[model samples]
Target chain A: MNPKIAAYLRDHAPATPCLVLDVDRVEQNYRRLMAAMPLARVYYAVKANPAAPILDRLTALGSSFDAASWEEIEACLAAGARPADISFGNTVKKVSAIKAAHAAGVTMYAFDSEPELKKLAQHAPGARVYCRILVENKGAEWPLSRKFGCEMGMAKALMVKAAEWGLDPYGISFHVGSQQTQTGAYQAAIARVAMLFTDLRQAGVNLRMVNLGGGYPVRYRAEVPEIDAFGDAIMGAMAEHFGNALPEMVIEPGRFMVGDAGVVSSEVVLVSRKGEDDPVRWVYLDIGRFGGLAETEGEAIRYAFRTPHDGGAEGPVTIAGPTCDSTDTLYEKSNYRLPLALDCGDRVELIATGAYVTTYASQAFNGFKPLAEHYI
Target chain B: MNPKIAAYLRDHAPATPCLVLDVDRVEQNYRRLMAAMPLARVYYAVKANPAAPILDRLTALGSSFDAASWEEIEACLAAGARPADISFGNTVKKVSAIKAAHAAGVTMYAFDSEPELKKLAQHAPGARVYCRILVENKGAEWPLSRKFGCEMGMAKALMVKAAEWGLDPYGISFHVGSQQTQTGAYQAAIARVAMLFTDLRQAGVNLRMVNLGGGYPVRYRAEVPEIDAFGDAIMGAMAEHFGNALPEMVIEPGRFMVGDAGVVSSEVVLVSRKGEDDPVRWVYLDIGRFGGLAETEGEAIRYAFRTPHDGGAEGPVTIAGPTCDSTDTLYEKSNYRLPLALDCGDRVELIATGAYVTTYASQAFNGFKPLAEHYI
Candidate 1:
C-alpha cells in the first residue's frame, strides 16, 4: 500500500468494508502514464473511477475525458473539464443521451454499428466520430466479450457512412482488454487498426486519429509489465505501421489510471472450516462481490491481501463476502490462504481496488449498503 | 407477460430500461405457495427483491421474511412485520449487524460456524439459532457455492454447542439451490435434515424446525416441476423419516416466491453483426448484466425475451447490454434467437425477472442509472 493511504487508514481507522483512496496516488498514476507515453493525449476513461475528487485532480492535470454516458460527461463538466476535451466514448448510446451530449457541446463520439452511427447522425448532428474495431484479446486476464467493436469490413463502411451523414470521421479505436499484461496485445491491435486506417485513407476518407483504448494492467497478486513497456510497445507499433504520418494519438485508460490507487478496508466477520478434517478455512469478510468487488467474478482479478498477521502461520482458505448468495463468494478455487491467526473482527485490506469497485456495487443486495468511499 | 404489467407498460409508457412488476401476482404466488406447502411456514427471502411494494404486499398477506442483513430486517419492520416473524437467516453477518438486528428485536438466527455462533451467543443471547448443513445441489440450475453450510458432523457439533452456549438449537437447514428443477433434490435434502434432527434429538438438543432453504424454480425458457411436486416430496420424506411426529416445517423461498411476477421493459439500442458473413446478430438492449439481469451470469437463468415481432421468423442472436464494458454482455453462448425484424428503438420485454433483478443493478455503472422499477 502507498504510504499516504496507510497513514490515513492507521490514523482514522474508518469503518470496515469501505474504500479509502489516495487522490494523490491517482494524480501520480496519471503523471506516470503521461510521462511514459508523452505523445499520446490522455483521455481518462470516466467509467473507471468517476469520483469527484479523482476527476477534479485529473481535470486540473489537463486530462481529456472519455465518458461512457451523459451522466459521466456531466460529471466531467462539473469537474471543470472543457466540452471539447470530453469524448462520448460508448458505442451503444441512447438517442436522448446523444442529444444531451451534443447540446452540452461534447464533440467526440464512438460507434461500431450502422444503427448506432445513424442514431449519432440523427441526434448529434455533425459530431466527431470514431469507429471501434474488434481485435484479438489473447493475453488479457479479463478479456472483453467482443461486444463493443465491429469487424474491419464493417469499420470501412461505417467511416464512409459517418462522412456521408455529415459527421467527422475522426478516428479508430480498439480495446485490447482490461488488466492486459502482455505488451504484444497492444502491438497486434494497433497493426490491425493500421490496416483499416490505410484502407480508409485509400478510399478518400482521411481518418486523422487512433484511439488505443484502456487495457493497461495494475499490479494485483501478480507482477505485470511496467507502464513504460506498454508505452514503448504502442509507440514502436505506431512507428512501424504509420511511419512519419502518425494520426493524432489518443489513449483512453480506465483501469490503469485508478486501479491501484485505492484499497478496500474490511473486517473478518467469521473464520471457520466446514469440518475438522477440512483443510480450507472459510474467511468471511464484511465486503463481498456485491459490495463492489465485482471484479472478483470468476476470481479473474485476484486482489492481494494485507493482514496484521501476514507473516504468521498460514492455511488454505476460501474467501467470501457477507452476502447470502453463494455467487458472492469471491474466491473459492483461487487458492487464497490467510493467516492462521485470522479470526472474527480482524481488520484486513484488499489492495489495489480503486478502478472498478464502487459503482459496480448492488443497490443494497442482501441488505448491505453500497460500498462507502473515502477520498484522502 | 402479465396483462396488468403489459397494460401498465402500454398506458404509462414509462422510460426504457424499467421493471414493471405485477404486485397482485405476488399475492397470487404467495397464496399458491401456501396452498402447496400447507404444513410449512413461509419466510420470503428478502434478498431476492426488497422492493417496498412487494414487501408491503407480502407483509399484508402474512408472510414471514428471511433477511440476510440488518438493513433487510429494518425493511421488514418498516413493512409492519413483527420482529418475531422475521429470521436473520444469513450465516455470515457482521458484529455490528448482529447487534443491530438483535436490538431491533429480530429473532431466529442462522449459523454455520463456531465463531458466528459465538457472536450470536454474545450479541443476541438465547436467540433461536439454526445450523445450515451442506447438501448436494445436483439438479439446480443455479447451484449454490457451498459457501453457506458446514459438514453434517460440524453441524451436529454446532447444534450441541448452541445449547451449551445458552442459545436455542432451533433446527437444521439446507438449500437445494436456486431454480431447482428436480423434486428429488428437496426430498434428498429433507432426508438429510431429518437425520440431523434425529441425531440432535438423541444428543439431547431436541432441535425442532427444518428449514428448507429457497431453491424453488421459476419457469423461464424451460419447464420445471410444479410447486405441488416439491411440497409432496418434502412431506413424503418427512413422513417416511419422522412418521407422525414431524417437526415444525419452515421454508425460505427467494426466487420461487416472486421470480416470474415481473417483466423488464427495455428498448433495442442497436442491432448489428460482427461481419457480413457472421451467422449471429448482436442485439443490444438498454439493460444488461450490471443493469440487474445479474442472474443471467453464466447463462444460468435463461430469460425468455419478448420482442415487438416475436412471432415472426427468428435468427440466432447474441444479446448484450448497453455499456462500454464487454462484461456487461448478458448472453452470448445461450443460443438465444430473436425475431428477424427486430431493429433499433424496438420495445422488448425480458420475462420472469421479478426476483433478483432490481437490487443487482450496478449504481450508475457506465453512468447508466440503476434500473428503474415499477410495481403496479
Candidate 2:
C-alpha cells in the first residue's frame, strides 16, 4: 500500500471495501498525458469515474468531457465545464436524451446509424456530429465488437445524410476498446479514419476534427507503454495520413487518466481451504465483482493486489467477493496469489481501480452496500 | 407479454425500462409453493428482490425471510416481519452485521467455516446455527461451485465447534444451485444431509431443523417441473432416509417464489444491422446487464422475451444493453430471435424476472437510471 493511503486509512478508519482516490495522482496523470500529446485536446470520459471531486478537479484543470448521456453532460456542467466542451459521445441515445442534451446547449454528438442521425437532426438541428468507423480492435483487453461504430459505407451515407439534414458533419470518432494495449491499434484506426475523411471530403463534407476515442491502457497487473509512446505513434500516423493540414485532434481518455489514481481498500472476510487435500485456498474479500470490480469480468483485467504483508511468503489463492452469489467470484481463472499471512481485517489494496470501479458497482446485491468512495 | 403485465403497463404508462411486479402473481406463487410443500416453512430470500411492495406482501402473508445482511434483516423488520422469522442465511458475514442481527433478535444463522462459527459464537451467543454442507449441485442452470458450503469433514468439524462454542447446532443447510431443474438434485442433497445427520447423532449432536436451501427453478425459456414434484421427491427422500421421525423442514425459495410474479418492461433504444449484408440485427434495450438483468451472466439464465410485435416474422438478433461496453451484449451465443418489425421505443417484456432483476442493477453506469420497479 502507498504510505499516504495507509496513513489516510488509519487516520480516518473509513469503512472497509471503500474506494480511496488520490486527487494529486489524477492531476499528475493528466499532466503526463498533456505533456505527451501537447497538440491533442483531451476530453476525459465521465463514465470512467464521474465522482464529483474527480470531475471538479478535471474541470478546474480546463479538461473537456466526453459524455455518454444527458446526466453526464449535466455533471460536467455542474463541475464548471463549458457546454461546448462536452461531447455527447454515445452513438445509441434516447430521443428524449438527445433533446435534453440540445436543450443543455451541447452541440457535439456522435452517431453510427441512420435512425440515430435522424434523431440528432430532429432534436439538435445543425449540431456538430461525428460518424464513428468500426475498426478491428484486436489487442484491447476489453474488445468492443460491433457495438458503437459502423462500416465505411454506412459512415459515408450517414455523413451525406447529416449534411442533407442541415447537421454539421464535423468529424470522425472511434474507440479502440477499453484498456487498449497495442499502439498499432491507434495507428491502424487513424489510417481507417484518414481513408474515411478523404471519402467524406470527396462527397462534399469537410470534417473538422478527428476524435481518437479513449482506450489508453493503464498499468495494472501487466506492464504498459507510457502515454508518450502512444502519442509518438499517433502523431507519426497523423503525419503519415493527414499531412500538415491535420484537423483538430481530440483524445478522450478514461482509464489512462484516473485508473492508477485510485486505490480500493478491501478487507479479507474469510480464508478457507475447500478440503483437506485441496491445494487451492479460497480468500473472500469484503468486495467482489458486483462491488465495483466488475472489470474483473472473466478475470481478463487483473488489478494489482497489495496486502498488509509486503514481502511475506506468497501462496496461490482464489479470491471471491463477500456476496452469497457464486458468480461474484473474481479470480478463479487467473492465478492470483497473496501473502499466506493475510487474515480477516487485513487490508487489500486493489491498485489502478479509479476507472470503471465505482461506476459499475451494483446498487446492493445480497444487501451488501455499494462501495463507499473516499477522496484524498 | 403477459396480458396482465401489458394491461398494467398500458394503464400506468410507467417510464420506459422499468420493472413491473404483479403482487397478485407473487401471492399466487407463494400459495402454489405452500400447497405443494405443506410441511415446509417458507422463508423468502430477500436478495432476490428487496422491493418494498414485495417485502410488504410477503410479510403480510406471514412469510419468513432468509436475510444475507443486516440491511436485509432491517428491511424484513420494516416490512413487518417478526425477528424470529428471519434467518441469517449467508455463511460469510461481517462481525458487525452479526452483532446487528443479534441485537435485532435474529437467532437462526448459517455458517460453513470455523472462523464464521467463532464470530457467531462471540457476537450471537447461543444462536440457532446451521452448518452448510457441500453437495454435488448438478443439473442446475446456474451451477454454483465451491464459493459457498464446506466439505463433509470441514462441515463436521464446524458443527462440533459450533456446539463447543455454546451455539445451538440446530440443523444443516445446502443450496442445490440457483435455477435448479432436476428433482433428483434435491433428493441427492437430502440423502447427503441424512448421512451427515446420522454421523452427528452418533457424535451426540442432536440437530432439529433441515433447510432445503433455495434452488427451486422457475420457467424462463424451458419448462421446469412444478413445485409439487420437487415437494414429492423431497418428501420421498425424507421418508427413505429418516423413516419415522422428521425434523422441522424449511424451504428458502427465492427465484421459484417470485420469478414468475414479475415482468420487466424494457424499451428498444435502437435496432440496427452492422452491415447491409449482415443478417443479424442488433437490438439495443434501455436495460442491460447493468440494468438489473445480470443473471444473464454467461447467458446462463435466458429469460423469455415478448416484443410488441409477437408473431410478425421473427428473425435472429443479438440483443445488447444501451451502454458503451461491449460485454453488455446479452445474446450472442444464445440463439435469441425477435420480431423483424421491432423498432425503437417498442417495449419488450422480459418474463420471469421478478426475483433477480431489480436488485442486481448497477447504480447508474453510463448515467442510465436503474430499473424503476412498480408493484400492482
Candidate 3:
C-alpha cells in the first residue's frame, strides 16, 4: 500500500469492498490518451465503471461516452452528459431502452440487423444510426466478429435495407474485441471497415460516422500493449486510410481509460496455512468475488499487494477473499512480498483494477458496503 | 423454454433475475442422498444460494445448514435454524459477527487460530467452538487444501491454547474443498480429522463435533460424482471406522442440494454470422458476470446452460450475455440444437444453476442488478 493511499483511507471513513480512484492518475491517463491520439474522438466507454465522479471528470474533459443500456444512458444523463454526445453503442437493445434513448433525445445508436431496424423504426425513427459491420480480423489472435455486427457480405445489404426503409444511416462501425493485445487488430479492422465505406458509397449510401468500437487495451499486466505505440499505429492507419476525408472517428475505450487509475483497498480478516507440501499461506481479506477484484476463474489476473510502510520485506502468499468458495482466490501466485507476514486487521490495496473493477463486483459476502471515493 | 417457467417469468415482474427451484428434482435428489446414507445428517451449505424461500424448502426436507458468515447465519436464523443446530463454519470471521452468533446462542463457531480464539473469548466468551484444521488432500485432481486452515502441527497447539483459555473446544473440522469430484478425497479428510480428534483427546482435550466441510459434487456434466454413492461412501466409512463412537457427523453440501434446481432464462437479442467457417449466433440475455452463471473469466461454466424446452430438434448456437465485454460468452459450444433457427426477441433458459445462482450478482456494467427470484 502507498503511504498516501493509506493516509487518504484513514482520513476518509473506513469502507471495505469499495472502489478508490486516484484522480490524478485518471486525469493524466485521460490527457495522455488525448495527446497520443489527437486525431480521434475518444468516447469513454462508461460500461467499465460509470461512478458519477469519474464520469463527471471524463465528460468535463470533453470526453464523449459510449453507453450500452438505458441504465448507462441514465447514468450519463445523471452525470450531465449532453444527450447528443451519448452514443448508444450496444447494438442489441431493448425496445424500452430504444424508446428511452429516443425520449431522452440521444440521437446516435448502433444498429446491426433488419429486425433491429424495424424496432428502431417503431421506436426511435429519426435516430442517427451507424451500420455495425463484422470486419474479419485476419491479423488478430481472438477475433470478436462473433457477435455485435453484420459480416462484410451482409453489410451492404443491411445498409441498402436501411436506405430502402428511408432510415438515414450515418456511418459504419466495427469492434475488434475487448482486451485486444495486438495493435494490428485495430488496423486490420480499420482497413476492412474503410473498404466497406467505399463499397457503401458505391452502393449509393452516404455515411458520416466511422466508429472503431473501443478495445484499446489497458496495461493489465506489464506485458500488454504499450499505449503510445498502439496509439501511433492506430492513428497512422486512420490517417493513411481515410486522410482528411475520414468521417468522425469514435473509439469506445473502457478499461484503457481508467483501469490503472483505480485501486481497491481492503482489510485482512484471517491468516491461515492452507496445505503441507506447499506451506500455502492464506490471507483472507474483506474483498471477495463481490469485490471489484474477483477475476480468478480462467487465467487469474494477478494484482500487486504491498503494505503502507515497507518494513523492508515480504514473502510468497496466496491471497483469498473472505468467501468460503474455493474459487475465491484473488491471486494464485503473488509477485511481491508483504512488508511483514500480514495478519488479520491489516489493510491491503489491489492496484490497477480501475476498469471493470467494481462495476461487476458482488455484495453478497460481508455487510461491507462500497467504498467512499476521494479524489487525489 | 419450459412453458411453466416462461409463463412464471412473464407473469411475474421482470425486475428480478430468479433462481428457479425444481421441487421434484430437489426432493428426488434428497431422497437419493438419504437412500444412500440414511444414517448421516445432510447439511445443505446455504452460501450457494441463501434466498430464504430456497432455504425454507431445504429446511422442510430436514436438512441442516452450513453457514460461513453472519449473513448466512441470519438467513439460517430467519429460516428457523436453532442455535445448537447451526455451525458457523468459516475458518475466519469478524468479531462483531462472533458476538452476534453468541448472542443468537449459536455455539459451533469454527476457529482456525489462537488469535481468533482470543477474539472469540473477548466477544463471545466461553463460546462452544470447533477448531478448523488445514488438512492436505493427499492425492486429488482439484486440491483445495491450499487456502484456509491451521496445519496439523499447529492444530494441537491451538487446541491446547483454547483449553487453557477455558474456551470449550468441541471438536475438529476440515473442508475437503468445493466441487470435489473424487469420492476418496472425503474418506482421506475424514480419516485425517478423526486422527486429529484422537490426538486432541490424548492431549487432554475432550471434544465431540467432527465437521467434514462441504464439497459434495453436483452433476454439472457426466463427470461429476454420484451424490448417493458419495454420501454412502463417507457415511459408511464413519459407521465402519468409528461405529457407535463416531461423534456428531456434519457434512455441508452446497452445490449438491441446490445446483440442479435453478435455471436462468434470458432473451436472445441478436444472431449473426461469424465468418466463412460458421454462422455466428449470439443470444444476448439480461444475465452478466453478476450471476455465477458467467464463470470466473466470463467463460461459461461447463453444463451451465440447459434449455427448459427441448427445442425438439436443435442447431448449434452460442449463448452469451448482453455485456459488451468480448469475454462475456455464456457457452463456447452449444450442447444441443435450438428448436428453430432463432432470431431476435427469443428467450432461452440456462438450466441447472440453482446453486450459487443469485439474488446477489456483480453490480458492475450499467448498475447491473440481480433479477427477481421465485420459489417454484
Candidate 4:
C-alpha cells in the first residue's frame, strides 16, 4: 500500500470501495514527466480522474489540460486553468459543447472528420484546431486507435481545409493507445504524424504543434518500462523527424499522471467455491467493473491487488463485484491468486487505480452507491 | 416507435441522449407475463433500471421486487412495495446490506455458496433463503451462469446447512441467463431443480418455491420467442418433472419487464468517413458504451435504430459514442447500417433500450452528462 493511503486507512478508516489518492504523488508524477520531456508541455487528461484536488494541484503546477468535453474544459477553467491552456481534445464534439468552449474562451480543439471540423469552423471560428490522425494500436493494453482518429489521407485534406474554413490549422494529434507498453508504438506514431506535418506544410497548412496524446503506460500487476523510457523514445523520434524545427509538443498523460497515485480500498463481500472440491474460490469484492473498474473488460489492464492476508498461503481465485449482475465479474480468466485465509469483510486494496475509475463508475448500479473518492 | 414515446418526444423535445420510457408499457408487460404464467409470481428485477417511476408503477401494479442490494430494497420499499414483497436476490451480498434488508422486514434471500448462506443466516436470521445452482447458459446474450450460481452439488449441501444455520431453506433457484431465448434452457434448469427437490424430499427436507430467476428475453434488433412460449415450456417441464405436486413458482424478469418499454433518444454528434474511399461511415452519437450501452461490449445487444430518414438509402456504419475513449465505440463488428441522410445534430432513437440503459450510464464520463431519463 502507498504509505499515505495506508496511514489514512489506519488512522481515519474511511468506508470501503472508496479511492484514496495521494495528491502529492500526483505532483511527483507531473514533475517526473516534465523532467523526462522538458520540451513537451504537459496537458493532464482530466477525464482520467477529474477530482477537484488533482485538477487544482495540476493547475497550480502550471499544467495544461486535455479536456474531453465542455464540462471537462469548464472543470479545468474552474480549477484556475487558463482557457488557452485547455484543449478540447475529443474528436467528436457536440455543437453545444463547441459553442460552450468557444464562449468560455477555450481555443484549442481536435477533430478528425469533416462534420466535426465543420461544427468547429462554424461555432468556434478562428479556434486553433488540430486533426487527429489514425495510428496503429499495437502494444496498448487498453487500445484507443479505433474510433477517434481519421486516416492520414483524410487528415491531409482536413488540415488544408481548416484554414479555408476559418479555423487555425494549429497542429496534428494521434493517440498510439492507452497503457502503451512498447516505446516503439510512440516512435511509429510520431513518424506517421511527422509525415502528415510534411504533407500539410507542403500544402501550405504549416501545422505548428504535435499533440502526443496520452499512451504512457503505468505499472500494474506487471512491470512497465519507466516514464524515462517513453520520454527518451518519443523525444528521439521527434528529433529524428523534425530536426530541431520541432513544433510545440504537447503530451496528454491521463493514466500515467494519476493511475499509480491512487488505490481503491474494497472489502471482500464473499469468498466461496462452486462445489466442495472446486479448486478456484470465487472472491467477491465491494467494487467491480461498473464500480469504476471498467478497464477490467476483457481482462485487459490487469490490476495488482493487496489483501489483508497477503504473503500467506495462496489459492486460485476468480474475483467479482458485489452485484446481482453477472457482467460485473472482474477477473475470471486471469490467473488471480489470493490468500486462502481471506474471508468476507476483509478489506483489499486494488493498486494503481486512479485513472479511468471514478467517472466510469455507474451511478448506483444495482443500487450500490458510486465509488467514493478521497484525495489526500 | 412506441406511439406514446413518439408522442412524448414530439411534445417535450427533451434533450438528446435521454431515455423516454412509458410506464403503461411496463404495466402491459407485467400483465402479459402474468397472463402467460399465472401460476408464478412476478418479481421485477430492480437492477435492470431502478428509476423511481418504473418502481412506482410496478409497485402500483402489485409486482414484487427482486432487489440486488440494500439500496434497491429501499427503493422498492419507497415505491410502496411491501418489505415481504422484496427478495434480496443477489447471491453475494455484504453483511451490512443483509442486516439492513432484514431490519427492513425483507425475509426472502438468495445464496450460491456456504459463505453467502452463512452471511444470510447470521445477519438475516431465519430469512427464507434459496440456493442459486448453476445451469447452462447456451443461448443467452448476456449470460449470468458464470459469475453467479454454484454447482448443483454444493447448492444441495448449502440448503441442508441453511436449516442448521437457522435460516428457512425455502427453495432452489437458478438463472438460465439474461436475455434467454431458448425456453428449453429454462426447461432444463427446471428439470434439474425438480430432481434436487425430489432428492431433498427423500432426505426429509421438503423444498418449496422454485425460483426461476430472470432470463426472459425482449425484442431488440431481432425476433425472440414470445413470453407465452417460455411460460408454456416452463410450466410443461414443471408438471412433467414435479408430477403435479408443484412447488410454488416464482419468476424474476428484468429486461422483459421494461426492455421494450423504453427508447433512447440521441443525436448524431458527427458523421464522416475515415478515409476518402472508406466504405463505412463512423456515426458518433451523444451516447455510447459509457453512456448506458455497456451491453454492446461484444456487440451482444444490437439495438435497432430510427433516424429521421430511416427509410432512406443506408450504408454500413461503425457507431460510437462521443467520448475520447476508443472503447466507447458501440458497434463495429455488428455490421450495423444507418440512413445515409444522417448528419450532425439529427435526432435518432435507439429502440428497445429501456431495461439496462439508464443506470449503466457513467457519471459524466468524458464530462458528457449521464443519459437523461423521463418516465411518462
Runs off by more than 4 Å, candidate 2? A1-3, B1-3
Each model's C-alpha lDDT?
0.90, 0.89, 0.70, 0.91
Checking candidate 4 for backbone clashes, the offending pairs are none
Q: After superposition, how far is residue A108 of candidate 1 from its true place, in Å?
A: 1.0
Error of 4 at B220 (Å): 1.1
Error of 1 at B215 (Å): 0.9
Interface RMSD of each: 1.0, 1.1, 3.5, 1.0
lDDT of 2 by residue, A215-263 (tens): 9999999899888899999999999999998999999999988898888
Give candidate 4 misplaced runs (Cα > 4 Å).
none
Q: After superposition, how far is residue A253 of candidate 3 from its true place, in Å?
A: 2.3
For candidate 3, the docking band is acceptable
Counted clashes in each candidate structure? 0, 0, 20, 0
Sorting all predicted structures by lDDT, with the top scorer first, yields 4, 1, 2, 3
Across B203-242, the per-residue lDDT of candidate 1 in tens digits comes to 9989889998889999999988898998888889988988
Ten-residue region with minimum lDDT total, candidate 1 chain B: B322-331
